[model samples]
Target: MATVTLKVEGMSCNHCKEAVEGSLKKLPGVKSAVVDLDAKTATVTYEEGAVSVDQMKKAVEDQGYDVV
Candidate 1:
């Protein structure tokens, strides 16, 4: 598995973290996702060949957060 730590912006509350986590969890091959509102980041564990980091970025962006 590959783990990605993404810097995210525009998240202000627990709901924002939840939104980010939920979005990533929906992707295929995503094993887990943790969103830290304090740090404004998300760490996702996924099957390497099943998903790409670019796709993960797009997934977060689709949920209205900036993925950096």
Candidate 2:
């Protein structure tokens, strides 16, 4: 598995955290996702060839957050 840590912006509560995590977990290769609201980042573990970091970023963005 490959892990990607993304700097995210505009996450302020548990709802935001859950939204981001849920979005990432829906991806086919994603093994796990953790969003830290205080640190404003997301750490995702996924199958390397099955998913791309760019796709992960898009997932977060699609949930109405910015992936920096």
Local distance difference test, per candidate?
0.93, 0.95
Q: Against the hidden reference, what TM-scores do the models get? A: 0.95, 0.97
The deviation in Å at residue 2 for candidate 2 is: 0.7
Return the top candidate by lDDT.
Answer: 2
For 1-68, candidate 1 gives per-residue lDDT tens digits of 88989999999998898899999999999999999888888999999999999999999999899987
What is the Cα root-mean-square deviation between model 1 and the actual structure? 0.6
Point out where model 2 deviates above 4 Å. Answer: none
Residue 26 displacement in candidate 2 (angstroms): 0.2
Error of 1 at 40 (Å): 1.0
Please list the residue runs of candidate 1 whose C-alpha ends up more than 4 Å from where it truly belongs after superposition: none
What are the C-alpha RMSDs, in order, of all predicted structures? 0.6, 0.5
